[model samples]
Target: MTDTVADLIARSNRLGADPKNTNYAGGNTSAKGTATDPVTGQEVELLWVKGSGGDLGTLTGSGLAVLRLDRVRALTEVYPGLEQEDAMVAAFDYCLHGKGGAAPSIDTAMHGLVDAAHVDHLHPDAGIALATAADGEALTRDIFGDTVVWVPWRRPGFQLGLDIAAIKAAHPDAIGCILGGHGITAWGDTSAESEQRSLHIIDTAAAWIAEHSRPEPFGPPLPGYGALPPDERRARAAALAPTLRSLASHDRAVVGHFTDSDVVLDFLASSEHPRLAALGTSCPDHFLRTKVKPLVLDLPADAPLEEAAARLQELHAAYREDYQAYYDRHATPDSPAIRGADPLVVLVPGVGMFSYGKDKQTARVAGEFYVNAINVMRGAEGLSTYAPIDEAEKFRIEYWALEEAKLQRMPAPKPLATRIALVTGAASGIGKAIATRLAAEGACVVIADLDADKARAAAAELGSTDVAVGLAADVTDEAAVQAAVDACVLAFGGLDLVVNNAGLSLSKSLLDTTVADWDLQHAVMAKGSFLVSRAAAKVLIAQQLGGDVVYISSKNSVFAGPNNIAYSATKADQAHQVRLLAAELGEHGVKVNGINPDGVVRGSGIFAGGWGAKRAAVYGVPESELGAYYAQRTLLKREVLPEHVANAVFVLCSADLSHTTGLHVPVDAGVAAAFLR
Candidate 1:
């Protein structure tokens, strides 16, 4: 062994002694040596690791062991049926019980699987901060790239060894493998280089995370989140195996590890914990090692393990009920099928992960992954928000034919290609009507309006269960416009169509029009449309999801309107805006168009004032005869309502209008073609 190994062992012992390393016992170190068995003429490469019951602070050379590397590898390959911890123990017993040497470290197999001459595993606080983040993988990839290979979280032992073997095969030149949700593993030709690499990776990742990621503030405990007892934890684990298998693979084996009833009860009794039962896995794959869901214990502080376990069973029943409710609300007949009762990974208030898998290694990976995911979720509460994969999308992946075929046979249709739409002024009038109609036809609608209350109420009336949300925003405000677009993603996942239906018009010719009037008209009718359409274009471009933008222009835009200079100018500008937006967003799969409507007067507060009487008098017609006069001017002579304009907007927003852009569709009852009567 090198002097660097001695230094690392000393440092490891100190770190284990610190109270901050409550979970440090979970890690270990090992070395390679040569040993000769007296009974046979066999020379073997010995892998010595820290013993299971020993702490690093007080560890001694006697605490380590010498095991045959070749034998260990052969045993792992042939007895893939053994559980991770069990396999490790069995391997240790085989080497020590008969031969008369100290037992090897629990991580002996992990050390043996690596190609490097030296290896070190540690779970530093800084490393955990990065590992527990939702974007941890991407961050790691950006930082390390091919320098490291990442194995999803799992339990420790024979299974982890297998995972390492696969990773080593894939990256023959990699310096080390970072176990997701667990800690960093560093390996190199020499012990010093391995330690240096491990330290550098952890420090670099920690600094980047600290600078880029905002930490969520710890809040008061929620009302009911707590830990559970061993018996209940075991039952929960067994129940979750089937569901976990469905999520990952039915052919995958399931195994359980780390169900300490005492630890669970102790965690629940801690005063410095959250109140609500926030159940989730440490990592995405952790569900495989630990069951998808754990039971939340809700007992008083200082409750005994037996009491907590009994209470946890009651809570488990409640969890099942709640899971059913969530399923009923979100699931459809076409939804993908899942195994087990619930898909949650960890019970709230529990510290360790319970993993399940087709085999021990896979199960360990699942457990480790679950632990990391849970930590990330907890850490992310305030810094940023996260939503799980969409229910429908989750179903598609879980019950996918290709994925299921690998395990068992199943039937389901591929997810249908669905359209998404964003409708401004959706609180009332044309916008609301259009939103309602589109949602009825199986489209996701994001309703944006200046009136927040009305928009929310409209969405509620339409059914909150539908993929729809009401966003309050002034479209003319660039920031607000961007936020609205983001809201579409945060709520409905993405954007496919934009309906610029919000506008304002004032009757004033050039001489009567004030700067304020022009500005106001421009703000809503021109600038507002520009802001909203621009934001939509950005999203569609990034996603490459072809989409449409429909501008609600006016008939006055093309034909002259007396005393309507501000209104008409803005309307004309809106038409031009469509042409410009279309040109820019076209290559990015977004099309822009406009709709000009005439004589459509339903629920417009614009027509409710004395201006209507003034208009009627100016035209030398009765107030009721105003409609008649406009009708006579058209060849069709039919009245138009807001619904007609909304219908026209829908057609332009639909895929039927694909390949059509920079055109204006007029819903005017043929008024533009009529000569003076």
Candidate 2:
């Protein structure tokens, strides 16, 4: 029944990868095996544990930090009576079994002290729901018998490891131990055995909860708008999104996405939501993500969008004031003050719910965890009077230096981390450049194009991560355009930036321009831009977060060429579209701008679509020299690369342009003729 070292590693990855088990990398696992010391040529017992904040799902052997079992245990004894948490951490690090510098988990010592050969720790909801309740220990022993023991919450340190070891000595047959207000630690002789024991505990506890708990949820009134028609529902979302977004944001733009399904409504509609929600998170690790509590926003659905938005602005202000009050109540004179974040979750009765983050991924994760928190609280309350560790414990876990270590290793926030953007015609050329640039800056981007496969491929090319998603959307089709916006929200949580970059280019004299060419250009450029801008604006407004819509227009909007009537005329319409949007959306705090880039033939699909030869011929230059000719035409004599246009979009979306809107910024390398007058 014994599992190999590699088997333990694989098992840990599989368990950690599932957020249902642990939201993000919040748990650790370890295995004991015999290995010869490379230098000493002597066999020793080694313990390999999940490193700090490492993702278990994709984890490999190297992801684990190896420590000598004797050495790990020796630290507690040699450093007995240690009072500070930092000293234990240093001792654990000092006992690393190998040359690798990867930090051992704070729980590494906890794992080492266990008697079993394999230990798998997790933060599964069901188990945590049972472990963190007011009657947690009583219920655990009742449901699990003597296979596990209860270890009261202790700020993790060397003392914690010693305590767990003492409990294990008392219950030698115990397969797991519940860490109060934290999680479960299940151990066995084999990887499968350990996982099976953990899952059994989770399932049995879930069953107990299901049988005993049926607490109902009741949200504040939403008015008749909750039963509004489909169009009305969409409209409702559009108007409300921006107000919440604005209230959540500070100096920079912030976005939000809704969780409005029956499940969410059930949580919001809970008659006891105010009391149940204040019950705190079912798991301790969530303190870092969800905070101690969620901010609830209740707005009447029937209120005019503007009025509701205005009310939200007021409520959010009060929410911040209350948040500061909570912080001021809990802070100690000895510690540095912990800064508060915008509410991680919001509840709007009759409307729905939302989770906020710096960007789409973060928003989605927060939302997901909030829902899980609701479910756990419901289950716990339905069975027994539910209780979680108080505000004091939350502050301890959330501010614990060792616990925050994983987050400290995270890279600095990218400029657009909280923003979600969708770009039309993103499979190639300028659109592609913009999407890639946005992803690099930490925005979650969606690529929409007529070419479904190409769009997906382009998204894949950007990376395997969720930074970019692809959708096959014909911007000219109203339904397709709406679907694209929906897809962006589904993937990224909310939409903040909408780039109308999909357009058709044709080179023809006024007399030679075909009716078909003109219609096609208008459909994709003018009409497409209108469709996408309107759809995206709805989501942005619903988020209540000010946003940006950057149009990838052409220099022809200002300096029309003789033969390109189709492209020039439609581009002018696109340019005008920006002004119209800005005029309408400015009151909502959304900025609309245009980037007029010239000489974009290098990466533009226009060259591949036969425009290069035609435009070169029209300009009386060799086809190979067309790009050079455009560069020469620029006052700066610089090639107007797609990257230049992408940078212009960044600038337009940045806080630098927060005050400037409804204006065209030329990205054509200083073409004086195309300059905005």
Candidate 3:
């Protein structure tokens, strides 16, 4: 990369990496420099601006759009009015220097039309506080004096760019200007100067708010609105997350995120929270993620849990109705169809906030945006009456065709997208394979195993927290099982699929078997499956979203292998539980299924635990050839691998098998003795 572009990237990263400077993927940055034109062999001025949907902190040269400066400036001659501004984005393609680096964002015109070598546009909380204040224009004058100007509210497009360019021309000495009811844009002749000015502006505004603003901005907490103790607050959040996720998924399924941070609790408990939340966020970027407003539950923190849950259901219904009315109020004949009537952010006094999205990252970011909104509200309220963009303007931005087109550009989701799964004993062996497969198919997985470190390592291989998390759980202990289930709920919302894969084996004749052997095998396989299923069932049923329960029973469950009384009986128990639960949970749309795999010697924890030697002796073969010996007996004569069984779990839980529940899929290389019949 050229030094100019490299410097611009460093500047962008420094500004964007800090939440105090900008929210995730919220702002854009640009640098103007000369580059050799490949065809003409002449140096030409070009604009390198952050591309559409690119995060500034992680921006690279590939994530920037390069356009000929002359072509960009020429657009002003053919500039359409505000009504036709969106068309300008298409025009940017014609301005490309060559093949172009990335797709130009809507803010491209703002960066290109400006008269500067370096520019930064950010949504710093303090700056937005002044931008959204009721007396914002005057506040800008009082705080920034003539060094910064105030531009009236204008939706981002070619018009806003032209407006900023005009202001810069009028005030040559001014370093930047606060874009009214939006964010702050600063520019300078050099990259360092531009970054410095941006920080100075943001820091100055923050200092002003801190020094001059009135105290008790959020007002005192109401009677009974004090935050619940940390433990109770978290437990309450976990209990309510499933129901809230269900409500949020009324239109479509969504993953959820919960947070009871000090800031959120303080905001929710304050007397002024209801009014401020109802007025909604002012910044377009903030509202786009958080929604126009949050659904605030009008209940105390210490209320009865049962009452709180029932009230949440009632409040959720009202939230949807209100959202529908809002859509009706502003939708035009040409407006995009209503996306959904569900709120992205939900607020409960004393408890915390719940945010939902198609996946975990989106949900977590939505909550983060709301916290940014809360900071903006605090600043604006402290200085003057908190004011945001007009409701009509917010609607216009929320339903903008450009925004809809952006959504359309996103890749289609994977098969198990938005599905959350919990896999027991997933640190290694078949369980880990199942977890890996599920994560690859787009489900956020919880790798639960007795070995905590290995479970964590296995989960780490899957991906970030958005994809998988690991925890310790001994299925024999009911509390540990419940905690594992609850941890899944806390990590990525609620559970949609549970894989009961934790198992052990003992190959002893009935006469040789002791009570300890029978009980040990039964505890881990039979009672373990029961404990895990029961714990996860409460969450799935509470979510009211249909789910899947897959048991990794053995072929021995039905094959009646000799000298394996304890292991065989437990597998039988697991096999029967699948059938029985299928009958009981069909009304709730829960599918229960089993995968019966034999000769899975390689990578098999059971075999590695000495069961292979015992089984090899029983079959009168060397332990080294146990897998082949078992495979030779099958009709297909194929060795069963962990991946094969994982594939079976995927198919059983996949939409293709939505109607094929209460079934056993045998992944034992066509062993006729273990066939479903």
Candidate 4:
């Protein structure tokens, strides 16, 4: 890449990475440069702008759309009026010289039409504060004098780009302008100059707001609205997430994220929160993620837990009704259908914010955007009044055809998408494989294991915290088991699937088995499975969302294998627990099942923990041939691996077995003796 293009990427990263500058996937950056045309071997002036759906912080050369500047600018000749501006987006594809790098965004016109080497259109909270102020035009002049101008509100399209170009051409010394009720746009002769100007504008605006702002932008905290103690608040948040998730998923199932950050707590406590929140967010990017407004749980910090939950239900129902009304008020004959009635954001006075989306990252980003909106509210309230774009205007952008197309273009979700699972003893072997597979199928997973570090490492291997989180828990201990369940709720809202995979084996003959050996095997496999299931059941039951619980039993549960008294007994205990729990939990829409796999020695924790040698010795086979010996005995004569068991778990928990419960699926490569009768 040329230095100019590289600099633009670096500058975009610098600005986009910071939440103060722009939200995830919001805003665009551009660089104008010369590139040798492969067709003509002639130098051509091209515009490299951040592509549609690309985040500035992680932008790459490949994420930028390359267009001939001459063709881009020539569109002004056939520029339709504001009503027909959307048509211009399609016209951009015709401007591409040779193979374009990425799809062009609507903001392309704003960067291409402007006469500058580098341009930045950012949605910095501080700059947007001035942009969304009631008297934004007047505030712009007062804040930056004539160096920065103000342009009236116009929907982002060719018309807005033309308006900005006109403003820049008319004012020779102007460095940038606040796009009224939207964001700020700046340009410079060089890449460094443009970045410097953008930062200066944002920082200067923030300083001005801080200097001339009210002592309490959100107004003083109301009585009983202060944040609860950290432990209490988080505990409350964890307890409340499942129900909130249930309410939000009325239209479709969604993963959730919870935050008790100072900003969220402070906003919830403010006297002005109700009114300002009702007015909703100003930025299109902000509202698109957060929705028009958040659903506030109108209860104090000390309210009874049951009372608080009841109030949340009422609040959610009311929010849905109001949202439907809002959609009805503005939807035209050709407008996109109402996407969902459930609010994306939920606010609790003493707790924090709960944001839900199709996945964890999207939910987390939605919460981040709401925080940005709160900052904008603080600044706008200090300047004049927090005047966001009107309801009609917001509805227009929310239901825009282009946005609908973007949603439609999203890839199909995986089979386990939106499901949250917890796998016990998932640090390695079969448990880890199960967690990895679950995450790959789009379910957020918690790697719960006695080995804390390995659990964390296993979670990391899956992906970011949004996809998997690791926690330490000894299922034999009730408190530790409960803590693990709470942590899972705190991490990704709630649990939908539970895998009782934590176990150890002791292959001792009946005469040789000690009391300690019997207790150890039974405690880890049987008792531990019971504890995990009971704790996770509370959350799933509270969610009122049907869930799955799978027990990783053994082929020995059914098969009578000699010299394995303690291990075989414990596996049999686990197998029965699955049937018992399935019968009991079925009333609550919870499915319980089991996977019986034989001689999974390759990656079996059981085999690795001295059981392999003991069992191999009893069978008169070398340890290296134990798997093959077991495989040869089975009808299929195939060695069952950890992944085979993981696949069985996935199938049991997936929608494919929605109607089948209390069933034992064997992963022992056809152990007919171990098969359910």
Candidate 5:
């Protein structure tokens, strides 16, 4: 039930950590018991600090490493050499591991050297604004005076510890030390005191920078250079690199510089101050905090900065490409791959840095870091040179297997994933309507018809990119049906839905029906539907995306009409095929449905003439009477369009009717009901 020293240290670290703050790792802290054991009189155990990689936000009781103070002091004496320091650090870490503790941090030596019970370090951009300047030490003295001590940049281990010790010895009243090119280190009797001191130092430095630094002018330029070609722009960029590099080689300088002839020429050509060009950020670390860069556009030589910024979108595309390349190269293997590039920063000719991100949180962080870095470089009299990880290294991270796997595991888009559909007699009429509708709804539609030109035209009208294809074939031929469906899968990605809308109907009584008439009717309607559906189902079943076979049955399937023996019998056979398919494919996620439409008025030249004339003759009435006859039979009294049939097909193809398989949707105007009455 007793609280352990390890528990207290873990609690303190957790209370102080902030995961949202990227710069939190730059700070350090530690805690330990000060009293002796009541019964044994043994010194209470001490907890040494862990450094950077330790996220205090999630620190648990086991995270704290109990280090004997004597051992820590001995390790610090031998930590001057990098290799020796690493070895000693590893050895101490192993010792902690043996004691079931988290590995001790590399910065433990510095923490041990501090005299306070708790220590904290922070590398805030606001604080670094002063630390990165040429006369940063002098500036710190002027601002803080005797409140804090200042230390020059040194390798961060034993040397930093020794420097901190010397500074504290010289200024016994100092609350903390501002380590040059690094961050601030503060200490106190407790974690709160250390945290407050660190915050005070950052706030003080931020105030000083604000008071001393003048805001750089941004906005439109009068006018300057006009547009230039890519080659010339590249040459100009090369020409300016040396100057840019010279300006970048200062402390705390993360600079990005670019020269564009178009921007430069535009400003020069215009009446604006065309001589000024833009600058960008130089470091990736800056990108994590401030984004990439700013845009500096060239206005007329006499133009104001404000006007140039207003028209600054010209460079957006190029900046996005560069940002994408940087992200592609530098992203961690565990990070998501860039689908496309984004504009994180923009450079305007004659203007200062401008940072951007998709949201305010990212934008604010980027702006703070970028503006501070620009100030540090400008105050230092030049930009500091910093190298980012190379493209190859970045690519390795971007394409890491874990990230790829994570992305691949996401669910695919529905209604189109590997589903293929074929429309017969698609050159005109209900076939064309069905083909167009299927393609629009994401199914790959294959238009097969006797007219090659009409099939191709229908495919083009469907707006199917590559999913809708045209084939000139008589659907009745088994060989042609096989080839057509094969091509459908290849073109549309897969085969799943078959709208058996191709059919020919001839009116003939049993006495008048000849052998040729019977064969031809059966061939196109019964034979064609069977062949195409069979071929499609094979592929659909193989794909396992659930296959649908939709037979375009006529109202004749449910009614007996005069002089319609051959046509009526073929349609009945087609309807029966749907029932059989449903029974067979029910377990495979495939459904079979039929649309029994009374009359479809839309088709090619053939339907408007031959079929239309035949229907008129069969009804013993004018062709115009066809619509009224069908509408009068239905309950809704609505004239059925080809789209009505197409809509029914869509419902059958979807999962909404998954449980209602082997059914028929009467697209007719209640004609079956009229017949029953």
Candidate 6:
């Protein structure tokens, strides 16, 4: 098959999807094509390369900037200076075919200089691990024989492009170039050859590491730090939420969330974790996401909660100073004046690691990057000292204008911006809609559900791991409820919104209502909510920032019908809790509200799960028309959607209804009977 721009992107995605090849969007790819110049009216060679910040896994034609090949190659002599990053940015922008598209990768010239139809520059962990080793060049030569050329570490731009071109000129048959202490670049006339070359190098380096690296043998799992035990870490994290979040935020607009995945905890537990983590990111390219280093904390299991919070604040101040010092000591005269915001990852001994991002997807990506860092760092340390490129190179990559351009490519923020949300029963139905709406509006949502697998599936559907987190928590279980709250706080820096949307209904009348029926309904909607609210309120109060706890009550709560005793009574009980808790939490700047939705049976799942056919029978309507039947009963005469319920929850948590708390809002297609009196 003829290699097209799409084919190039297809191979780039293969390399990007695996962290072993690239983590996040830390790689670039390009394809050579011919396009008709609008002005010249003649066919011209064009280079379509992955733009800066565009993830290869999701790259499309738009993400690949189009530049005239001759114009890009001419920069070798026409460009004013090699050392000026600003010059490189302007030159790349000026060479673009049009305005309105993404900025080309800083390595655009390098891709064009490859003298092949396809070019791929990847930051595979194994390749970087091998490249950063002490005798890297010699090892690279030994591993790839004469098929790959070795290029010493150099600032990425004019000089590096020129260097690669020279190597290809000197070694015409070379399949790739090993960028010592950095990454590797593979090129070929077709996508298959270029991808195969990249895979071969990564596989070769991974095999070498496997043969030589003898990792530290861990003892049987010891309980994590102090009498606190691992089970209590989530609550401790929740207790520490406000302070840690304050520490992570430079502007306090974004939230830093927590994850205690076994991977992070195992890294923390490993004997060599401290030394490995201190060495910084596995590759300098990763500094933009993981930050230069993580802030490490050791909390005494039995330490006073207030004391721990205060101590963390002090430590974070120290971390900022240390980060600034590191910058001052290594930053060159040409480096960016602004220090990037606070560290994206934090480590707490006995607890686990926390990763921060502007949103949910960004946070999860940052967290997962650190997990990959741990793996690479561990392997490198076990075999040899974990050595990445020099501090200067790391700062260059971290502060590089090209790297910052990726963030700038994104559209305007949604209303929630950096707010964090935790929604229970978020695996499907009404809860899922709430999570989706919150994330779409720029909130980092946590999918808290009884089904662990479904929660993860829900999280994955939201796009990036950073945008949504899935945690299995039975809300009725006090410990689990607290942990879910902690997970939200830890994952997003601090929690600002809570949606008590998880509930089950019995739909039984007074006489038919079994003891178990009443108990189960109350267990989830009432007791479960109490546990979550108590825990969440503590964190929000400590943050001193106004937040919302919007309970998903029911219209039936206000007007109970026949055979709806358990569900209606339980919902009504929680509806009262909303007013009472609202009054109480208002003193702490926390708003407690309720969303009473009815006839959302089709999508709410509460109605569809055995209740739909029964509800249709009661109303003497076909089950298929039950939603419409209920809709006509209301003043609006419109079917109440799950999204409508989600909107009501959003309003309760948002500035639109900011002044109203202890208020029960109805979202039941305008049910006059359910309206607040």
Best lDDT among the predictions, by candidate number: 3
Q: By descending lDDT, how would the candidates be arranged?
A: 3, 4, 6, 2, 1, 5
Clashing residue pairs for model 3: none
Distance (Å) between predicted and true CA of 637, model 3? 1.5
Clashing pairs in 4: none
Error of 4 at 9 (Å): 1.0
On lDDT, who's better, 1 or 4?
A: 4
Report the poorest 10 consecutive residues by lDDT, candidate 1.
Answer: 245-254
> Which scores greater on TM-score, model 2 or model 3?
3
- Per-residue alpha-carbon lDDT of candidate 1 for residues 403-443, written as tens digits (9 for 90 to 100): 33434533331121245578998887678888887776656
lDDT of 5 at 468: 66
Task: Show model 1 residue runs off by greater than 4 Å.
Answer: 1-417, 609-614, 622-628, 673-677
For residues 641-671, could you state the per-residue lDDT of candidate 6 as single tens digits? 8899988887777778778999888888788
lDDT of 5 by residue, 146-197 (tens): 8887787654556567678677767878889777755678877766676677
Candidate 2: list runs displaced more than 4 Å: 1-4, 17-20, 78-83, 211-235, 251-257, 299-311, 403-408, 472-496, 514-523, 526-547, 572-593, 619-641, 651-677
Candidate 4 per-residue C-alpha lDDT over 1-677 given as tens digits, one digit per residue, 9 for 90 to 100 = 89888999999999999877888899999999998998899999999999999999999999999999999999999988888888999999999977888999999999999989999999999999999999988988998999999998888989888999999999999999999888999999998899889988999999999999988889998999999999999989888888999999999999989999999999889999999999999889999999999998878887988999999898888898999999999999999989999989999898999998999999999999999999999999988899998999999999999889889999999999999999999999999999999999999999999989989999999999999999899999999999999999888888999999998887778999999999999899899999999999999899988999999998889999898889999999999999999999999899999999888889877688898998899999999999999999989899999998889899888887899899988888887777777
RMSD, one per candidate, in order: 25.2, 4.0, 1.1, 1.1, 19.7, 4.9
Q: Each candidate: what lDDT?
A: 0.60, 0.77, 0.93, 0.92, 0.59, 0.78
lDDT of 3 by residue, 275-331 (tens): 999999988888898899998889998888889889988988898899889899999
Model 3 worst lDDT window (10 residues): 668-677
lDDT of 3 at 671: 80
Better of 1 and 6 by TM-score: 6
lDDT of 3: 0.93
lDDT of 1: 0.60
